[model samples]
Structures are given as structure tokens and as C-alpha cells.
Target chain A: MQDDANNPEKKVISDEEIKKIAQLSMLNLNQDELEMLKTDFGNTLKLFETLEKKDVDSVEVSYESSKISQPRRNDEVLHDNKTQKQQNADTSPYFNKKTGYFDVPPVIETE
Target chain B: MLHKLSLKQLHDGLKNKDFTSKELTGHYLDRIAKHDVNLNSFISVTSEHALAQAQEADKIIQRGEQTGMLTGIPIAQKDIFCTKGIKTTCCSKILAEFTPPYDATVIKKYQENNSIMIGKTNMDEFAMGGSNENSYFGLCANPWDLTRVPGGSSGGSASAVAARLCPGATGTDTGGSIRQPASFCGISGIKPTYGRISRYGMIAFASSLDQAGPMAPSAEDLAIMLQAMAGKDSQDMTSANIEVPNYLSYINESLKGKKVGLPKEFFQDGLDDKIRSKIEDAIEVLKQQGVEFVEISLPNSVLAVPTYYIIGPCEASSNLARYDGVRYGYRTNNPKNLESLYKDSRAEGFGDEVKRRILIGTYALSSGYYDAYYQKAQKIRKVIKEDFDKAFEKVDLILGPTTPSFAYKIGAMTKDPVKMYLGDIFTIPANLAGLPGMSIPVGFSNNMPIGMQLIGKAFAEPEMLNMAHIYQQNTDWHTQIPEKYTT
Candidate 1:
């Protein structure tokens, strides 16, 4: 919206691309939702077109703030206490008390 | 009568044996019970639990043990913080039935201080929207005008405090959540310097920018609440190991020689005329106290909203990928397989705005667009921070209108997400820079409260609070209550 040159490379995304994005996001969007997202993304992405005008070629990415992270703690294998484990076990349907392991449906499916 | 008492008065009352913690807690609970029907500010009102905690706090005071400013005080926690065995919905349907097995570090700190946990406040689900409308629990209203929204995602906390539902509440800011709502609802709130408070057990949305702080009636109360809430934690590595100063000690410090910058960019075209006039009046108050205001520029200020949306959604998409229906939170009733479970559960679990952010984030991080969107946004984020870095070189802190205008009507801005994102313009830059920022009640505009934001250099929270305290002393804005709720 600024200048034609400022908007030279507008990232145009397609509806098919929206479906793939929903899938990658693990969200099952219905057709209408997908259609809405196409327009939504188009409008939202236009905000970024403004970013291209700034000459930030030499600027480094800040994954976070300027503060340096605290030093890592040493790895220690401290087991959870019994009551705490029981409290956690109550949250899951598949916790195996006898085996001390949580069970899940087998990853391999035979059709 | 009790609800109107300042926090220090409540503490003194508890200490002098004038009223027990149970009585104080009961008074607040009763207020929330009666008044909250108009605001919907709470998701879970833990009345029984709160009273029980108040009883315990009474015992601690009875024993003559050590105590702090929050001892026996009742405080509301934003539902984003996981309270063990309490249904901690971040006002999302996905977590509507989800209760955590552990307390957030901020909650634990308050508990250690023997502060009573009144209830869990409502918020924009997963801290996604600029308004509380995005919540599954329903929209939270401004106490001043029930038809309008309390600017969110900390809307519930702000509204609750404004209506005297609770004395103080904890709110997390990713973009403008805490400050904006505080602005809208005519209360006070601060988002401490990044890592000033721990995030352990506080549900993440854009983990990089999310930091917790306090919302209260006044800046002095914020100093007390922040003292309890801040410090480093082993559970949150991003929490700064730096020492938290005695905020209250520094709160009463002089404002005579301190310099504050009024960014010309923030005061430019977008701001409402009334808000600008109020901020100028606030400037006069500060100037009378010998504080000087310099007109400065943050040239890239317009770019903050765009930069924050990209980074916020990207990290949110990744952080939120954890809710795949396996362990906790909502799961689809019957699923054919793991993939369907993940898809169906997430689709049904999240709201429209949340889904939009996840999709945008996913699309940006996917194979080809990562560099163009995510990486480019990160680079621009650095430029925004450097802009602040340059400004701080000349001024002690920055001052501006907390929102472009005061709170809009509930359904007014909900249809347009990009426009709603732009509304966060003034508050987003501070989150980007990892600086400490706060909003205090300045004056009223069109019968709605206006907030003035004070952003200090990183770790300059004491100065910010101190300066806010000075403004509050000179004006009665912070002490005013909504007329309809006054009775």
C-alpha cells in the first residue's frame, strides 16, 4: 500500500496452500474456514510487505531479548515421588501401574 | 467499605487484628459474587479454596511469623497460570475441563507470602487477541461501561480490579494484554522487564514475549505485588538471575531530575485527540514535579505491530503444538487414528482467532516462507529494540498513550483482526525491546478511562513505578471508581 516499488514482491498464497498449512498445523479446517483463511492470510501478509522496504540486510535475528540466558543445570535423574506420580497417573487413561509405563495405541496400523 | 481500602490499609488491618483474613477474603468474594454478574471477570471463583487459604493465612499471622506486603491479602490470578487441582482455563474451551497438577511459580510465590487466592480471572483464550472477545468463556466487559470491552487479554483482571472485585490480580503480557486492559478499565498494571518474573506453569503463547506482571488500583500496590511475583526460577531458564530490587523502597523516590521521552511517533496521527490532550496534561503534572519531557523519535515505531504478529504467532504455533489431545486438554470424542485425533481435537479445541494465528504461523514456518516471514520479522524486531536502545541513551524512560483510543465497543473491532492488531501499537514495542512498561489511570475520555504508559529501560522497573506513583499522587484518577459499580 506504500509504494508500488515497496510492494514489488507480494507473497501471494493459494487456497490449496491454506489446506496444506492447516494440515501442517494439525487443524482440521472445513472448506468455508479455509476460504476465509485465504483472504485473512492475504490481508495479514500485506503487513509484512512493509518490512521489505527497510534495509535490514546487516541486522541479525533476535530469537529473544538482549539478556543472556542462565547457565544450564546439570542433568539429574531424580524420580518423581509416589504421590506425585499417582496424581499424574490419574490424568492419563493409559498409565500402566504394574509396568510403570504409560501405554498408547500401537503406532503401526494394519489395514 | 473493605473493598475500597488500599492494599496497605488491608495489610495494616490484618496486622493490627482489626479484621481477620477470612473477613477480608469474604468481603472480596462477596463483592465478586454480587458485582461480577455485570463483568464476567472470573472463570473460576474459588470461594471455598480462598476462604480456606485465608484461614491458613490467619493462622500464620496468629503465630507471629515472618510476613510480606501480601500476607493475608486476596489477589486474583489470570487463568493462564496453572493452579493445581483448580480448573485453570485460559478462558479457552480446550482447557475448559483441564485442571493442572502444579501451581505456577507466580502462584506459589503468593501462596508463600500467605496471600489468599481469590479466583481465576478470565482472559483472551491463550492470550491471542487484543480484546477479551476471543475467549470461549464469553466477553468480559469494562466496569465503567458494561456494553464495551475491557481491552484484553487481561481484560478480566482489569475489569475485576476496577469494579473492586479483587484488590490486585496477576496478568501476563505478550503484546499489550495487561497494559491495554488496565488502560481501558481505569486501573494500574505493569509488565516487568522480560524475565523479571518466571513463566513456569503459566501457559505459553509466544513464549519469547510472554511475561507476567501485576494489575492493581495504584502503582504502589503494583510495587508490593511485584515484590512477591518476581525472582529467578530453575523451572524457567529465561527468568533473569539478576536480583530484584526493593521496589517499594525505590517507589517513593524523587522524580525531580528524571527525564522521560514522549515519542513523537506514538503521539502522531493515529492517537485520539482526547488521549493526546490527557497525556499532555499528565506531562504537565510530571513537569510540575520537575520531571522533564523530551520529544524523541522511534522511527520504526509503525513496524512494531507487524513484527510482533509474525514472531508472536510463530512461537505460539510451535508452543501450542503441545496440545495434540494426547495427555491433557480436550480430545475429540472418537478418533479413527492418531492423525485424525490431532487434527480433530485441535480444530474443535481452538477458537477462530487462535486457528488463524496457528495457520499463519504454520505457513510462515513451513518449508519455503521461513526466511521471508519469520527470519525477516526477527531482523526487524532487532531494529525496533535498537530504536529503544537509541532512545534510552537520551531519556530515562518513555511515556505515551497506552492505546490509540480508549476502549471500543465490544463487537466494534472484532471483525477486523489486522486493525485490532494495530490497536496494540503503543504497547507492543516495549515487549519487543524486553523493557519494563506500565500503564496508570490518567483521566477520562468520552466517559471511558484513559491510561498513560511509562516504559523504562530494561531493569528500570523501580524508576517506572516511582514515577507513576508521583503522577498518581498529583492526580485523583487512580482513586476514582465507576459510578454504576460504586454502590
Candidate 2:
């Protein structure tokens, strides 16, 4: 048996690493949640580690394997302004909207 | 009584005036009210909307107009499909109250046929987990045993059908979501070739893997539903523009010279003894009908679960990036800053399983691990697909167990995510290969239903359904309903 495979603690992800991952994923987890995620991540990653042994050196990655591809249509307006306005209005409740535009936190800080 | 009828039977009944569409819809609504308390199969029961649609269907039938097979039959939509003016939560808190402003192409097709919409059924949150336990609403129990899961993330649709809540329902499969639940619930379902059904408004989980299909009591009923559901749409670029076959007409095709291949790896260790024996017996029944079985090898199929876990989560991480607090869905209240706003809203909206997959996916696609994890998994995915490609050269289709075992008790595999994933071993290869696969109730093992999977080449649903239909005609397993659910 491999030395690291037998040691359960060997793959334990650090708290800082988990925090960085959560940040990269745009998730804010509490300290308790972070600890739980670390253990869960460790277990799942161990399962994923089995892929390293597979021989895929000659295989090519496929994005879309389907042979049927539709020809692109000429660019034309499919929807009227009313439909666009309704769709815009639908998202008004989730964020700050002023004059049919979404309002967000300022990108730059000024004194 | 109306709930007991199949889609074909229901269509005939409506035409013969044996029952009105409104009465049929009312029967299912009453059952949903009476039994859904225990099953928790439905997220929202649209009685008023269903009655209104049924009344409209009755008018069409009265006018002596030619109508499709699903004209007035009641059906449920899996909550993942976007329904205009109806709440489609996907059983998650993030989109808990969000209503789509337009109908998904599948919903539009059913509505155009005037099929009564019973309700939106429950599912694993965002169709993530194999078991229904991951839903924000609550776990859905198997209608057969009540203590067991109905299998997910399409568990609610399967349970609702098994319990006679509706004639049929729509289900989406990424990795065995439809077929596993169909197997566990003793019903029938099919996951057509990837892009066979439009995914324009079906909420994305894994884009390349997800395909929507029908769930019903028998392959014939599924054919009836699939006739109405399959086709290309301009809204979804990935929807296949291939010829949609007349599945209903092909149901009675002879299986005399058809070839069915059994993957040697599928019958190996980890499969339950009883389920294996039942599948063997089912193969004998098909053999008597003159169907020939050839031994085939899918050597890389053993890697399906690992490959699926990597690719599924990675795509999910990128797809779910749209759920930030910017536009629609749940937003964190009073966020201090932009980063916290994105973080807190997602952290608060998503459940544990969803977060876990997001983390795994993000880590897989992270700077240092991309080539080792996500890219490598994709290459292995091609190998898995090739295994099926080579097998199809010698045989028309492949046969296997839908799941390795019968439905386990609710919460049994929740603690260990890997064990839950292992349950999908037999079903994941079809998704990886983007082939059409069906599951039909072959027999019972320990009083629980065992489903035998029939996988066909891309867009070969008619052939797959024909094989299953012939098997159903020779056996009575698909007609057997749970005693507790049957009145």
C-alpha cells in the first residue's frame, strides 16, 4: 500500500486552503461550515484521486459529440422592446434598479 | 379510477366519452390531496390551473378535431422545467418563489396538445443528488415501502406515478436521475440521446450530460409522451435537429432478430445477487421472444462514476455562477459590500450538497488542478464513450441493471456521498456516451422492483422502446402497482 493512501490525515485540506477555495467559488462559509467542508472535501478528493492512475495520454477531450449542428441564422431582432422591458422588470426585485438599469456597488472609491 | 389508466387508455376514454377530462383531472388532484401528504411527491399542486386546462381539452375533443395521444391525459412536470406564472423552485431555496415568465419548450408542447398539468413534482435540489434527500423541501419516500427512497433527483416524479397520482410525468436525467428513480419506484422512464429534448428553459446542472425525457408506467405510455415531447427548438442551440420518429407506431415491432448486448463489467461484483438473478431471468424471458444476447465488453465503464463526478461538478460550478445576487433568485439582505453580497447570497441560498459540489468543481478547475482533474476526466469521458461506440458495432443495443440494487432506506447513503454515487454505476455510462437509455420494471427482488436498462445508439429511441414494449407485452411486471397505492 502507498504510504499516503493509508494515512487519513495526509490529505486533510488546510483551513486557509478551504477558505481560498470558498472565496474563489464566491461562497461565504462560517468557521463551522468551513471545518465541515474541509472534511467533506478531503473525502471527495480522495475519491477523485483514483483518476490519476488512468491512462488517458492518447485520448482527446470532446466538448460536443453530436453530429447535428444547426446553421446560424442571420442576425435580426426577434423580440420587441415590450418583451425586453418585461424581462428587465422581472429582475427588479432582486437588485436595485433605477431607470431600467441595475444598480450595484460603486466600482471605484472616491473621497 | 382515472389515475389507473395509461396515457393511451386515458386518450381513448376521453374520446369515447367514458369520462370527461375535467373529471379525470379532478380524480388525480383528489389523490394528490389525499396521498401526497405521506409521499411528498408534489411541490405545488395546480388544481385550478389543471381544471382550467382540462376544461379546454374537453372542448377540443367535443369539436371532433384530430388530437394527439396525450390530448387530455393528466401529467406532472418535474419542478426543474420552467412554467410560466407558476413557481418552479427545483426544490431549492434559491429559486423558491421565482416564477418563469415563459414556458419551457417541453411545457409548451404539452400545453399545445392540451395535456392537463397536474402539478410540479419535487426533486433533489437542482437535480443534484441520486437520492431525493438533498431536496430543500424534504426527502421523498418510495411509494412501495415508504421507508425507502424513490430514487432521485427525479424521485418525486417516479413516486407520484408509482402512487397513481398522475398517468405520467416529465423527468430530466444527467446521471441516472430519471432511470434510477424509475427503477426504484417500479415505473418506466427514458433518457433520450443528449439534446433529444430541448433544454432551453430546463435549469442547467451539467449541460453536456443533461437530457429530458418521459416517465410513465410502461414503455408504450412513454412512447406516447415522447411523441409529444421530442423535437428541435430554435431557443436551444444544442437541441438536435434530427428526425423525431413516430415512437407509438414502432411499439409493436418484432424483436425476433434484434440483438441486445450485455456488458460483462455491469454484471461483475458490487451488483446485488437478487437483482442480478432477476435480470438474468428477464433476459431469459426476452430470449424466449427470439431476442439474442451477445456478451460485450465496456472496459472503461468502471471509470464512469469517477469521470462523471469530475465533469458533472466542474460544469455545474461554471453553470451555477449565474446564481449570484445580481439579477433573479434569492439575494442576501443588506450586504455590506459587493464581494460579501455575492458570497453571502450564494452561501445562504444553496444547500450543503450544492455547496459541496461547487467547492469540488471550483477546486477541479482551479489553477493548479485543471489539467490533472477536469481535463483528464474529460479525456477519460471520451474513452468511456468509445467503449459504447465499439459495442454498438456488433449489437443494436446494450442491456444492464438500472441500479446496482433496490431502493435503500431514506438517509441510508446520505452520510457517505461516494456510496450514494456508487448506486449510479450502471446508469452513468449512457449519460457519458450521450445515448438514449430506458428502464422498465422487469421483476421484483425482495418485494422491490428491479429495472433492466436498455441503451440504444444516439437517436435510436424507437428501437429501444420497441424492445421494451415487446418485453412488457410478454410480462406483467410493469402493470403491477404497489398494493398500498392501489385502491
Candidate 3:
């Protein structure tokens, strides 16, 4: 097992890429945090780059819990406990009692 | 004396009228009150709730008909499990005020067995970091030395058990969250085979990799607690339908003629000499008990860390996308629109480590890079799993150091996230393979405890526990308490 864990070369994540990924992740990072992440992700990319050395062409993708051979249950509305459902909604901080939906800031904006 | 008692000892005391559950619970509560200010092990100490549960457990003992081993016993839970009507925060600000209407199957199991819930242990927020420094609650200290970390994200649970704040605690392991901390704290913890424990109501980290298990002062206590914890649940579709084995029946048995594989990859040049020597000493002890050690090779284990980081965060990024602030978690103040509600809420709520993983995950799973990063990592994961499968065919168990090194000072390795990622090389492979693994206190280096990891085949927790119990019977390492924690 060769330990090349600290090799920091061959892949440079650009600024536009960082902003795009953060947008996709739905996180708003400030300028300083984005700068730090660029460095961090650069190292992460390099760390993962070592995996390219392994000849994995013939290997299949194996999930961690592949051993759990469960039968697929019929997908239907299983919960009939409406009171329990309401209680669940009530546990949230922004649940609206009268509207019967979650409360959030208005989505559509118009002048 | 109460602090030193195992779970079995505590159960016996209650059954024989030697001590009331309230008194026992109070003993641990008093310890938490006195010591947790220094340890920062608990995010929220449920004293009133714990006392009430203790009263109920005491009543059940008085009835004395349907009581089980866990009845009248006090234990702590990692904040990740959702407790019905009680605040289950996962130690993240995102869900700091959020309560669930339904209890996690694991929590429901403990409640059903009449066990007392003492508190919610702190962790690396959302179970992200290798050290507890990433916790939103505060720095969770190793009881042995307050300045050093307890090797997280189960740092709080490990510290509580090792410091004797509680007789036992539950910890979830995605990538060595349980075993690494148990190693650092000089206690016993196990991550049972994946799917062996239900993950329902456990706030997701990496859904496929996460599994909950028990941590305690001794392997026998772990066996007892794990038995109560393990089972199939319909709520968790991934939870194994196989009947839970009687773990106790597997332990207290001889280890004569048992074959254990010492993976060559685990002892490569990178392992600290002091830690390596300690693992060798553990092997000598097992050898005396008629356990045969064979050197085996798992070639692809070298890539485990790199492979896991990609897969874990990719899953985490997808899983954490649920915290959009419109539903149950923290909502940002004065949101201008829905997009601001999602972005601003997450930005204000999640910690740095959590954000780091999410960013990496999103990038890996992105359109053009998916095949290069995420798919490549998954294929490598298969390579690592196959290595374990082959090793198991040659031997019944794989034994090695639980961590590459002993606990480092806080802030020492956090700056270099890659170095911190490499620290998990030994523990990551077991999680990658979904095999059952555990850490037992083997010896010490520089007054810090060393842990030897034992990885068993999938669904082979009984054999793993039997080996650990037999080793614990021969060694007093598990019984040694920190000098500071001793009254």
C-alpha cells in the first residue's frame, strides 16, 4: 500500500466551479470561506485522484449495505393516523395550523 | 463503586433490592453535573426526564414480572436518534429547536425495555469530523486529558463511559465514529454489521454506511446492550430481516483453536510503532488463549480512505439537501424568497465540517464529474469489499490497530483535512465493507490508551464479541479508570 495521500497536484478547481457547486448544495459561503474551500477541495480532489491509479475498469459499483436483501414493500399511503400526522406537523417550528401546510417566506416576487 | 459497576452488575443490584434505580441514576447524574463542565460530553443533560424515567423503571422493578436486563438501567444516547416529543438535535443548530413526533426505532427499543434515558451526548455536528472539535455544542474532551480530543464524532459517548458519567451510551459509526473514540477513551464500542441495526429516525449522514452500536466500560456490557439494541424493523427497510442472535450465548466461550487474520495492509509502514507494539501484545494475549494469528493480505484496502470520502460525502450532500428550512429544521430570519430561505438557512445552521462535506459531495455528484469521482470511488469500494470477502474466506476474523495513532492534541490535525482523512485509514475499510468491527482497549502509549480493532464477517458479531470478551477477561485494561475521573 503506497501512501500518496498528500500529493497536491494535477487538478485545479476554478472559482466559477466553487460557486456553482455551492449553489447546487444550497449553501451561501462568504468570500473567505469560499477561498478556504477552494484549497480544501483541491486537496480532496488530489486525495481522491490516487484512486485513479487502481485498475477498476472491470469492477462493479458495490454499495455499502448491499447485503440487506429486503423485499420491496408496496408503495402506498400506509399511514392512516391523521392525528399523528398533524402532531408531526406541529413538531416543526413553522407549521401553520389554519393553512394545513408548512409556513415559509413567500416564493413569488412581483413589483 | 456505582461508577465502576458494569451494566450486568447494575441490573443485578436493582433486582436484588441493593439499590433503587433513582439512586443509581442520581449517582450518574451527580457525576455528570460535577464533571461534564470539564468534559463537555453532553449537549443536553435530561436530568428531570431521566429522573422520571428512573422512577418508571423503579416501578417496573417493583412489579418484577416483565423486567429484562436493560430494565432499570440508565444509559445515554447520541443526539442523532430522534426521541418522540423530546428535542433530538443531532448536535447541529439546524435542528436545535426541532422535536420529532416519533421516536427512532432504537430509542423506542430502549424505552420498550424500560431503560432510563440519561442525556443526549454531543458529537461532531451531524457526525462529520474525526474529532469532536466540529461539534456545535462545544469542545468534547477526552477524560484522560482534557486538552486532547476523544476521537469523535462519538467523542461525547466515549468520554461519558470512560469517565464513568454513565454505565453505557449509544454511538453511531459511519466511519470509525464509535471505535476510534472508544480507542482514545479506553472503553469498548462496536459497530455491528451494517443492516444489523435499524437506522430509522437516525438523522442521515451516509445512509448506507451508518449503523448504531453500544459503548461501555467492558465487552460483556457491550454484549448485553448490543443484544437489546439489535433487531429487524419494518420502519427501516434496510434493517436486516434475519433474527437477532442471542449475543450472550456467543460470549463466555473459549477461544481455543480460533483463527484470526492479521491483515498485512494494517501493519504497513505508516502505523505508529507504539500502537503497533500494543497490537502485538494483544495478539500475544490471544495466542495464550489458543487463538491462532495468520497474516493475510487485503491489497485494495490501501484505497479505502480515498474511496470512502467520495461515497460518504456524495450521499451526505444528497441526504442533507432535505434541510431546506421549509420543513422541520432551522429557518433563517427575514428570508427574501424561497431560494434565500434554503441557502441562508443552511449557511447559518451547518458547521464548517458539514459544509465541507456537502461541497465535496455536490462537486463529486455534479453532471460532468460524476463518472470521474463518484463512480470511480464506488468501483474502488467494490475492490475494497472484495478484499475483505477474500480475507474472510481464509480466516474467521481480521485483527489490527483500531487507529493508526493515539489521540493527537486538538487543532493539531484539523488544519490539514487530508491528514485527518488519512488518520481514518484503518477504521474506514470496515465501514466500506459493511462488516462488523469493534475496538477494545489493548494498552497505552504516552499515558494515552491504544485500541486494537477486531473485524468480523458480516452478521458475525457473536464471534467478534466472544473474542473481545475473552480478551477482556484476560486483561484489566478495560477496567482501568482515568486518575482524574477517579473520586
TM-score of each: 0.96, 0.97, 0.97
Evaluation by DockQ, superior candidate among 1 and 3? 3
Which of 1 and 2 is the better model by DockQ? 2
Which ranges in model 1 have alpha carbons more than 4 Å from their true place? Answer: A1-11, A77-86, A93-111
Full ranking by lDDT: 3, 2, 1
Number of the top TM-score candidate: 3
| Weakest ten-residue segment in model 1 chain A by summed lDDT | A2-11
Off by over 4 Å in 2: A1-12, A95-98, A103-111
lDDT of 1 at B1: 83
TM-score for predicted model 1 compared with the true structure = 0.96
Candidate 3, B1-487: lDDT as tens digits: 7898888889899998899999999999999999999999998889999899999999888987767888888899999999877888888999899878889989999988889999999999999888899987887999988889999999999999999999999999999999999999999999999998899999999998999999998889998999888988888888888899898898988999999999999998889999999899999999999999899999988888988899999999999999988888889999999999999999999998899999999999999999899989888888788889898898989999999988889888887788898888999999988889999999887789999999998999999999999999999999989998887
- Of the two candidates 1 and 3, the one with more favorable TM-score, higher being better, is 3
Model 3: chain A TM-score against the true structure: 0.76
State the lDDT of candidate 1 residue by residue for B1-487, as single tens digits.
Answer: 8888888889999998899999999989888889998799999899999999999999988988877778899999999999998988888878889878889999999998889999999899899887799999999999899999998999889999999889999999999899999999999999999999999999999988999999999999999999999999988889999898998898777899999998999988878999999999999999999999899999998888888888999998999998887777888877777888889989999999999999889888989889988999888889899999999999999999999988999899776677788889999999998888999999997789999999988899999999999888889999889987676
lDDT by residue for model 2 over B1-487, one digit each (tens)?
6677778888999999899899999999988888999999999999999999999999999998998888888899999999988999999888997888778999999998889999999999999998899999998889899999999999999999999999999999999999999999999999999988999889999999999999999999999999899998888888888889899889898899989999999999889998899899989998998899999999999888878988999999999999887778888988777887799999999999899999999999999999999999889888888888999999999999999989999878876676787789999989988999999998897789999999999999999999899999999999888887787
Order the candidates by DockQ, highest first.
3, 2, 1
Tens digits of per-residue lDDT for model 2, A1-111 = 222323346556888899999999999999989977787788777777777889898887776656677878879877586876677466447544446655556556456
List candidate 3 stretches off by more than 4 Å: A1-11, A72-78
The candidate scoring highest on DockQ is 3
